[model samples]
Target chain A: MTEKPLLLLSNDDGFDSKGLKELIETLRPMADLIVVAPSGPRSGSSGAITSQVPLRCSLVSEEPGVTVYKCSGTPVDCVKLALNSFVPRMPDMVIGGINHGDNSSVNVHYSGTMGVVIEGCLKGIPSVGFSLCNHAPDADFSATLPYVRRIVANVLAEGLPVGVCLNVNFPDVPDLKGVKVCRQTDGVWASEFAERKHPHGDVYYWMTGVYVNNEPDAPDTDHWALDHGYVAITPTQIDMTAYGQLKRINDWNWNL
Target chain B: MTEKPLLLLSNDDGFDSKGLKELIETLRPMADLIVVAPSGPRSGSSGAITSQVPLRCSLVSEEPGVTVYKCSGTPVDCVKLALNSFVPRMPDMVIGGINHGDNSSVNVHYSGTMGVVIEGCLKGIPSVGFSLCNHAPDADFSATLPYVRRIVANVLAEGLPVGVCLNVNFPDVPDLKGVKVCRQTDGVWASEFAERKHPHGDVYYWMTGVYVNNEPDAPDTDHWALDHGYVAITPTQIDMTAYGQLKRINDWNWNL
Candidate 1:
């Protein structure tokens, strides 16, 4: 029989987040689990890596075929360190989040949780990022378990193509409408900065914004699926090359 | 004969980096500049936004047709603020960097310099990021000036397609090898954590590593061009959609 798949888990949320614990519990029995989460929260960290600074990791727990480390770095750093040093072998799959907030549409790029899985896909490992739309720390994952298992098992069963990964987001409802493969929605965060005065009489502006989705009617999109009742699964790739514009760009011909 | 193009400028190397100063000096004569950059360095801060905490900004300098602001955030944040509130109208182009370090190959994904330009492109603005392969704070910009001016003028003379941006990197040398339009070279940063003992006897791991590019022989790659002493110009896009894998992924039929 083939050995169980080694699963590496991580998130932008600190190690104490309930979502992390639940995800660990759910994944522990199924595969060889190794977690490298932040010592403190690192939400919206995106793909930041500590270049000029050194990153520190501390071991908090270990058991048979399972270990946990609290890292002092971004989600991308966590995954890089795990792949380069911590793991005995490159992981069969890398999973991130079961996060507290929505990372469905444009949020994926700004999410440290999703960034690592994206990094994993870049390194040719099968990867998936799971996020619950609700932002409550104690958000329930009871409804998310079956979907996670189904997707992870499917990925394990059917390996992903090179340089591709999955961005899976779940609706907040306890009753799900099952999973739907969708594309990223043309959505963005609209900014509304608030001006405030500090005690020292310094004027400061706070960057505040509300999630304003531009494609509400596009049912084939991740945003539409999650806004409805479905668990949204969007296949994401790392290649940023704009193949369509290559010809026009090539015409620039710097040699001119 | 028309009004000078309104050009938005930013960099990850803070406002003081000589590369940024050179870029500002080079373009100041030809454009109406709106400079917004981080208060301090934010090099590897890719796609990251200031969502959790509020952001603040201060006027750095102002001399008719030119306004520079220093913000307490990453490059992406600066662009977001400018697009949302700080600008009077949409700028003709958004240009980031003359960055002190290289942001070639896979490093583009972890670069705050390129992140701002990507954000600008997503906002439907023509944008480009300029980086010199030299990491020295005082890297010579003479080699970079002609390329930057040429690319910016070209991009301005003919706007980029929606969602298209450029990642331009120059080799740090006095000699010239011309420029090559290329695609992103597949590479990964192999992170090596430096384990250190704190004065209090606590174990800490610092993130450190050099990027070892494996796609050395691939002639059609950015890494190859940079190695051959040619400047690499890669047109980047915001869509992370792996259109090639869409059908195969949908075949999973999550509807089951």
Candidate 2:
């Protein structure tokens, strides 16, 4: 009999998120799971590490094949601590999210879910992050189960290359066509802050933004796939180098 | 007069950091500067945003050519807030750091300085982030001033490509050769967490790690340039896509 695969799981949302619960339910049968996630939501912490304070990780639950810990750090910190101290051996695969919202396009750069996935890839582990297009805390994740299971099984069977991970986003619609391997779309958030007066007359602002896609018509982009009600699997990497422009920069005369 | 070109300044270090002050003193004469930085140190806040709370930005000081504000947010937040609300018009260029520590190679992924620079570039403004090899809060930034001046002047004169920005690092050594446009080195932190006992007998851990460079012999990388006492300028971009692997991933049979 084969030993069950050890899977490291985490999410950007707090330990108690509905998304985490659903993910645990979905992956627990196929793997020996260990979950280490933030104590609370750390939504926009993209690959951020906690250097300012010491971290406290407390074991919150332990079952037959599952154990969970709540970490007082960012999503990346959870993975770091798990790999460095918690797990006895290298995990077969590392998975993050089943996140409460979409992490496609420019959202990939601002996602704590992708942060953990990136950290896993940087550590030479096969990793993937799963996010649904829905943003509600109680959003239905029933439609994502089959796709997530298939992807997870595939990644475990076929380990990803070094320095690469997958950013998988499922459309919110019920009638899903299929999965499409795509590239990250060129996009950014056009941010706007809403000003409000405090009780003592001091002013504060809340950040609000719209995701603007620069290449809305690109057929091979993750944004395009999701917009058309298909699951998007974008292979993400740790190398942020723009190799295409390297020659252009090297030719510049830096005589000053 | 060229109306003293507008320059936006920010740092990962707190508003009162010596590096921020030095940056102000160095760039003041050449530009109309507006400073929006965190109220306290926010190191390692790589592209983090404040979605959980409202941000409070208060004016700290004002002068003829300079205005400073302290923000209750991370470095990325400071830049986003400045772009969306504070600046009457988009600044000609955005510059981050004169950082107290190095942001070369893999450090770029974890840098709040680079976070602000990336945000600026995403907004289509020419941007540059400068860091020294020194990590001391009181590290002498005297050697970096000339290089910073030259780089900033060049960036202002020759605007960067639409999605690209600069990540420049200077060595701590005084005897510098020249500047080299380089690629990001392949490197990562081999983290070691120190276990500690709290006063109440609870166990906690502190994250500490040593950066390990995988390719020390690669002379074309930022690590090589900095090790050889030359200023390394790596033109970075907002796109995290691994285009080379796109075709390979697309060939994967998602037969499930």
Candidate 3:
């Protein structure tokens, strides 16, 4: 008999968030799980790492086939600490999220959920992050479970290409239409701050924005897929090199 | 006669760091400058945003051609805030760093320095991030001044592509070999934590690691250029899509 595959799980939402708890409940039967997640919400942390302070990781809960640890760090830091100190052996797969908010389109750039998977991919591990297009505290993920199982199973069976990980975003609907393999949508967040006068007569600002899609009509993009009630999976890579522009930049005069 | 170009400047190191001051001094003669940087060091912040807290921004210093503001936010936040609320108009270019440490190889994934430029690129602005391969508080940036000037001049005259930015790294040397337009090196940080016993008999960790380069012999990578004492300019993009793997993922039996 072979031992079940070991899966390392984390999320940008705190360890106790409904999204993460739902993920743990769904994945429990498939693998031996070691969950090291931030003790508090760390949304929008992106690929941030804690360097200036010593991190505290405590084993919060332990049960048959499941062990959970809460770390005082960002999602990326949790992944790093888990790989280096917590896991008993190299896990077969690294999974992030079942995030409480949408991580579609350019949100990946500002996502702590995606940060976990990116760190895992950098370590040459097969990684995937899942997000729902909902921000409700008790967002229903029931419709996403079967699709999640299928995708996870496929990734585990086939493995991902080196330097590539999956960014899967489920639309906030009662039922999913289907899954679409799509590219990241070209987009930007516009008018991103709200100015306010503090009680002390000082001006402060709140970070807020409206996403502006540059390619709204592109059916092959994540944004379009999600808008059509489909699960959008973008194969994200760690390399950010603009290879097409390298030659153009090289042609610039460099003589100083 | 054309008006002098406007440049928005920021850095991961706090507003008063020598690196930022050096950048300001060098570019003072070339254009009007507005500097918005974190009030405290925010290394390894990546694209993290400060949504949990209301950010305080203060105008700290004003001079003939230079104005500096310090904000209680990450490097990415500085760029967003500058564009949304601070700048008189969309700046001609957004520039980050003259950082105190290297941001080559996979360091870009965890770099607040690169976050500034990445945010700028997403906003469709020409952006560039500069980093020195030294961590000393008083690191010498004098040798890089001429090269910096040339690169800025070229970029101002010939704007970058819509979705691209530059990540430029200068080696810590008295004389530079030259410039190299390169790709990001494939690398990962290994053994990333040092376990320590807290005084209260609990385990804690300090994040530290050695970079492992997968392709040490790749002459066309940013890592190689930095190692060879050349100024490495890697054209970076905001798009994280793995286009080559799209067809491969689509071929998977995704039927659920």
Candidate topping DockQ:
3
Cα lDDT listed for each candidate: 0.84, 0.89, 0.94
Best candidate (score: TM-score): 3
Clashing pairs in 3: none
Docking category of candidate 2: medium
lDDT of 3 by residue, A104-173 (tens): 8889989999999999999999999999999888999999999988999999999999999999999999
Cand. 2: chain B TM-score:
0.97
Q: Which stretches of candidate 2 lie above 4 Å from their native place?
A: none
TM-score: the better of candidates 2 and 3: 3
Q: Tens digits of per-residue lDDT for model 1 on A194-244?
A: 777889988776767787778799988898998889998888888787867
Residue B65's lDDT in candidate 2: 92
Model 1 segments more than 4 A misplaced: A253-256, B199-201, B253-256
Q: What's the CA error at residue A162 for candidate 2, in Å?
A: 0.8
Mind listing the fnat for each candidate?
0.67, 0.70, 0.87
Per-model TM values vs. the true structure = 0.95, 0.98, 0.99
Cα lDDT over the full model 1: 0.84
DockQ of the candidate models in sequence: 0.63, 0.72, 0.89
Between candidates 1 and 3, the DockQ winner: 3
Arranged by lDDT, best first: 3, 2, 1
